[model samples]
Target chain A: MSKEMTGAEMVIQALKDQGVDHLFGYPGGAVLPIYDALFQQNHIEHILVRHEQAALHSAEGYARSSGKVGVVLVTSGPGATNAVTGLADALMDSIPLVCISGQVATHLIGNDAFQECDTVGITRPCTKHNYLVRDINDLARILHEAFYVAQNGRPGPVVVDIPKDVQFAKGTYVGRENIEHKTYKPKLVGDNDKIQQAVEMISAAKRPIFYTGGGVINSGPAASRALRELARLTGVPVTSTLMGLGAFPAANSQWLGMLGMHGTYEANMTMHDCDVMVCIGARFDDRITGRLDAFSPGSKKIHIDIDPSSINKNVKVDLPIIGDCTKVLEALITTWKSQDRHIDRDALDAWWAQIGRWRARNSLAYRQVADVIKPQQAIERLYAATKDRDVYISTEVGQHQMWAAQFFRFEEPNRWMTSGGLGTMGYGLPAAIGAQIAHPDALCIDIAGEASIQMNIQEMATAIQFNLPVKVFILNNRYMGMVRQWQELLHGGRYSHSYSEALPDFVKLSEAYGGVGIRCEKPGDLDAAIQEMINVKRPVIFDCIVDQQENCFPMIPSGRAHNEMILGDMAIDLDAAISDEGKMLV
Target chain B: MSLAQEKTERHTLSVLVDNEPGVLARVIGLFSGRGYNIDSLTVSEVSQEGHLSRITIVTTGTPMVIEQIRNQLDRLVPVHRVRDLTVEAISLERELAMVKVRGTGEARSEALRLGEAFRARVIDATTESFVFEITGKSDKIDQFALLMQPLGLVEVSRTGTVAISRGPEAM
Candidate 1:
């Protein structure tokens, strides 16, 4: 059945039909009609954000935590342009989002009229798909399709550009059930032959490792369960990328920590020495692969991913299976159970012994001083204080983000959110606010750096306005720690513009936003400060002053192989660290 | 195998995609953005009712790079199928070119002589100039244009290469 309604009303109805309960956006002239219609409806709550970029990042956080497609609405021109970075971030990290931007009237699109821009054209490369609603009759259909496209296989952001006239025009509303997509169907199940082959490889190999990534989390909780079952059935050790940290339980004896730059010594060593590498749901990104020529040179790799393009993009594989992670893992488990063959126990023991020796190095070790707070120690204390609570963690891109990933142990999926691919600096604060809105009772915290947190400091107002108790834990080192570390090691310690010269007092700033603030300068005061920040019933900014000269360790310097990482205790000669080959890579 | 050991080769890929606005731009943008080389490209609508368009692209890359291109093209939402005509099957390739020569005396006759030898049709003619239309493989077109250079070749406009497999079944 179809009913005649204005386009703005249809937009609301379509979102309702799609089960969207919250939308993050800011109002402007081009989107006034949609805003007016939004005001008339109470089913969907509008989250007014200070900046469009914050709006996008907040939706990303909401989507990452809740396993739902996040929604955003904004006006034309600058509004659409401001959302580009977030869209690119979502695209790289495979977050599902649907961003709706209002454009000028259809007749005024190309005439340089007020607030007119080519939204679809600008977002084409960043979005999974995009559409311009030239006719009001197509608005409802496009809105539903945008949601469908955003949440489907290898999900990414989608954009729907609606002109002002189309939002006000009267048109027939089309229900989602009436629409049939002809060209968009993703495969869900793996081929039986490939599953059998994978089982044979796993059962015969003496040394094997399961390398996982964010796709397992994106595949939902069932996939993570399947992963655990498969690991138990095969008695194989597992490791993950930075984005895949929570997919496997960190407390499991068979689990190796994250494997890449700044990863654990055991994880990277096993990745290099494994005979058969079972890569499930992870792309071999440049950061993960290190030097492509030397990456897992002896491994006969088997890759399972929903996106076929991810397989063999950077590292070649012996077998490739295209299917959803859960469905494919279920098939692999069934196949492995049916096979009667067993792995060589003696060789597996030898492999584990070698891995134990690497773990003995304690690659994440950092000396704790009596007066100053170490960043790693701060993260450890924060984790210990919140380990038993229902918590979600997000982080900005820098040394502090790496420390959070290393120290925060997650037993389940969807509890940790960070910018893994694009490495955006200001992603954590808004993302935390978004996650807080999704899970109102859960403790949502943004582990931030002094330099990174300032990138989106305006989001403090959004948190206070919504009465969100999200906490921003800043490891204040008074420098862009990652950049400074690289400068010291690779650029003769030039340190050009790497220091935070004129930083604001975050505690005062938080107080100014009608929120609580806590500052801890000594190691002895850290735990109480974190507790105070957590107990506050509103947004709080906890500034923990840390060692300024510290650097993230166990790092595979640029163009270096996995086995050639520099541990925390190892003394580094700057000249030797910056090799000619390292200079060739970014 | 390491990247340095692989030999670089040219491959022709045929892509079937939705015949919609910005589809061509998406294809072209992907090439430029990824730093992939596009030697030649041709696109035309193949099915009006189905709203399908076929694009033929000639690119040069290592074996791994070529595979990457095919996988990347297949990942596009609007794309239906991607076939590397050079390796998938026995294929035929062709292109069309229109060459104009501006010469009055012996050079004009010489241009006409060479055009006839290449089986080129004189589509437009004047007392001082002649426009010849020719169709053949890309290499053959290149050879013809090279021969026309000494014959006062004023201008040449050539369609990029288009290719199809030699089989009873459709791709």
Candidate 2:
């Protein structure tokens, strides 16, 4: 039913109709009407953020954890401009977010009026789609369309810019059920012939590996289930991109760990030597496919993805299935079940033996010195402390993020959130807050580096005000660890401004924000400190001092092949370890 | 050999997109943002009732890059369809150019003669100048412009290129 209402009221009504229960935003002069309308409503709770960037990141975390479209509201000019980074981040990582920004009055748009900037123009490249509502009649329709566009196939951020005058103008509000998109349908089912071809390749191959990515998680729980079924049924080992961490259970015997620059030895080796590579949901990003000329040279690759653009964009595949991961995996399982002949048992056994040898390297191992806590050890202890609870983890981009990916095991999809594609440093704290808001009683933590946490430290006040028990476990290494590591290896250790000099005592900072703070310097106190941080009923910043000189290992150096990874100090000489067959394949 | 080392080839892509504000900017932005080449482009509203516009873009890339271009164009939310006219079918490519020659004597007559030889029409004329409008393949327009250069060619304005498939199918 259509009813007459002011444009601002329609904004709230449209969101309510779309089932949005929360909004992350900061108020400004231009959005007064929308704020006034919001104040009148009790259905949608607004979490006021300190910075507009935090608002967007929080929405992204909420969306990633809850598997729903995250909503954000902001005012004109800088408010919209501040959201650009998060928009770009969401676009790169395929997170679904809808941002509504107030524009200057329609007449004053080009007059350089107060608090005015071209929101749609600036966000065009970063967002999946955007709209600027000139007429009040288009307001409700565009709001509903923004939500639809954000959460659909190959989901990404969408922006709707509403002029202040348009917000005040009276218009007829149309519910979502009355609106229909004519040209935005995405393909969800794969072609049967191509799926059959994929199944045939899987059954005939010996050294087969499934390289999964965020698409499996994005496809929802059903896709993860289908993936587990397919892996078990075909006896194929599985490795994932950092974004795909929890889609396949970490505890499963067939899991080969994450595959990329900082991936495990066995995972990267399997990617290089596998005869049949079934890549589902993950685009072969540059990080994943090192030295593209030498990547998986001998493999018959099959790529399954929902976006047609993702296929053949990086690594070309023999079979390209354009469909949702869940649908395609289901088809593969059914087709493989019907085939009388399966994988060659003898060749499979030999392949498993080679993988076992690679696993024996223990690429993730790092010596724990008695005097100090290694970052990896800190993450392992944190994982141990919270693994039994209803937990969601987010991370800032740094060495700590890598350690969390390597050591903190995820058993379910959506339990881990990080800025994978853009690698934004300030993503974690706000994201943890967003996740905490989504699942009120769940244990939410931001695995952060000291340098990365400082980027969005102001959000601690927001967490305290909202009563979110989000924990920020800071691995205090006193350096921009990733940059320091790179400088040491590639730039002759210049260090150049990589040090975290003039750092705030995170404990005091947390206390200043009216929250609890815990500091642990000794390795022996790590577990108890993590437990204390977890048990805190309010926002807490756990400052865990770790080894300052540690470097993330098992790294495929930039421009190097996947097979040419530099393992940790404990690893044996890899050149002598590779078999003659592996040498020939390389 | 790596796919990147392969020789690049020119391809013409016809894209149907929603005829709305900033839609063209979105299409152009994709090319510039991704570092993809755009040799020439022409766009206009094709269906008034359907609110659709057709954009014809000429780009040069390797086979893989060309495939990437098609897929990326198709991925745009406003884009309805993307058809590679160069490879999909026997297609016709044409461009419209208006050439102005500013000579009073033989150069003006020569420019007019060449324009007629290329099926050009005299759209405008003055005592000291003549403007000839011509429509043909992009190469034909290029050749006509080249010939007019020596004939005191003052200026030339050209619509880049527009193409259509030869078959009865609709893109």
Candidate 3:
């Protein structure tokens, strides 16, 4: 059962045991031995990345899309360091990933040796767990333990730092069989008492809204359907965060849509003005709740999440029901049916009527001055163009990102992946590539902002190499939309350096990189550009030049109440309408 | 944004250690925050000062980095001294861990008595598990931890690792 081999051999065996088919990484000086062993391995296909960060992100894309453990390997120093941010991204998102780093020889370790850094020490905070392999024989088990740790419980990344000597050194490599990890089993089954209490609360509440987050997306399609059914049966409107975009269908009448700063004015107002806010698997992040004291001022919150620590970590909760989101939701449905709580049809109908009025009166607007391309209009067209397709949508953070979420009208769960918690800029393109690889048959596209798209533009090589047919929708505004909007609102129109006149020709850039590129300047041409992108059957980048001055409106600025919104060009117009929607305004 | 990465300063930090498992975790957990980055970290098991083992870690950073690292290392309950060797350049640091394995007969006995001569212990002695303990430099430990593979080296528990500055004065 044992043969003399290098630590690299043991690691490869460990990866195979963990059922890893594809991995992302690059070779370096401290990891030559690993590369040599890796060269001998035939089972795993390694993706060559332009940078180590891309390697980490590609793995993240894979994990987020497939609900599997993503793997990344890199050499010591900068290679290991570059992967940290991506590791942090995965950690924050609770995506399962295993990162392996090569180190200098054990003797040359701290002698100020070139490319020598303590990989385990550096990555500890960013990872669920890390290991520094001082012994070669421990490699197999360490790798095994790493995979187990990364995938178990509320999944996160794990790093295994293997030194050069260890990778080259001789050892008996035993392929891991029946791995035992007694310390880390998460509770999959829901507790009945809390479920019963939650059921009772839901049944009793007259005006209830579901605040859903990434947990809804991560829990899979079952959880989304469960949340929807609960909302339908209870006559409660469901509002989602950016991470929870596709958790509930936007087309569903029961769905109240996005809630927060860039969220629909009505959804935010409803969550603010509701009686009971049932938060399922969503944290009361700063984006959702502008100020906790002023947030949902009249609502009694019931927070249900798998992670116990996340229960009361943000806003105050009346009931902290801790367990799996889907499990607890199903349990609540069971308890709700048994209770047979009386329906308040008048109150439910009245809430919907008020919401409908708010949506039409104070919807996000960009002026249609004949030639101007409103971001929202572009997004609506984009959504309309891609409707009914089982495709994955990834977006860069900014005004277009918000608009995409608002307009996409997504039906399936886990189909929408964006930088929700971290709000990372260069997330979309790579994430689209990962999603495409995870589901080759399904369409994948990146709705990117101009500045954010440039951040990870190097990943275009990956798309080209694999001939991944991911369409890139670049919402070009020639400025950082989010920062520009903030400057305009808070800093009294001090635009500063937000506008960059010398913008790169995205069409030329895409062409140079061997992909189809189209420039759609007007709404009339948007369809043609989109059709051209779809026809490529390879990578395509559509540089859609949106109106530069157009901003995401109905915004509740920082340190302001949700009701105190600047709806469109007329400030406080949204507030006046929302407050006067019905007679029962608190 | 500290975009211009200042050149890493070489620092030698010495730690007086009880040499226990999970001690390393506490030492390492301090520097893994958002702003802090560690460079050139080393640990060893040098016990010239009686029962206490002194660990030396050579790291590089600006003055601010050194101070933070030292302060964090000092906070560890098991650590007695966390002197920055960058400031006090001359202090000795060495490590010792021996690898013991089980073979059929001659190889097995050779490993045993070598353990005896090195003051190593047969920590585990099942028909399969023949654990031996020896102390030396990290490289020596690593080399031995590796060399015993053909002779059945199953698992490893290293007191990873301790460091000290080179020489005459105390850190």
- Top DockQ hit: 2
If scored against the real structure, what TM-score would every candidate get? 0.98, 0.97, 0.76
RMSD of each: 1.2, 3.3, 15.9
What's the lDDT for all of these models? 0.91, 0.92, 0.76
Where does candidate 3 stray beyond 4 Å? A1-4, A172-177, A341-343, A571-586, B1-171
Ranking by lDDT: 2, 1, 3
Candidate that beats the other on DockQ, 1 or 2, i.e. the better one: 2
Alpha-carbon runs more than 4 Å astray in model 2: A570-586
Model 3 lDDT on a 0 to 1 scale: 0.76
Q: Which 10 consecutive positions of candidate 3 chain A have the poorest summed lDDT? A: A577-586
Docking class of 2: medium
In angstroms, the error of model 1 at A485 is 0.5
DockQ comparisons of all candidates to the true complex = 0.70, 0.79, 0.04
Best first by DockQ, ranked = 2, 1, 3
The stretch of ten residues in a row with the least summed lDDT in candidate 1 chain B is: B1-10
Q: lDDT by residue for model 2 over A1-586, one digit each (tens)?
A: 7999999999999999999999999999888999999999899999999999999999999999999999999999999999999999999999999999999999998898988998999999999999999999998888888888888889999999999999999999999998887778899999999989898898899899999999998889899999999988988999999999999999999999999989999999999999999999999998899878889899999999999989888888899999999999998888888775478889889999999999999999888889999999999988888899999999999899999999999889999999999999999999999999999999999999999998899999899889999999999999999989876766566899999999998899999999999999999998888878877899999999999999998888776788888888845544444434333331
Residue A492 miss distance in model 1 (angstroms): 1.1
Report the candidate with higher TM-score, 1 versus 3.
Answer: 1
The TM-scores, chain A only, for the candidates as listed are 0.99, 0.97, 0.93
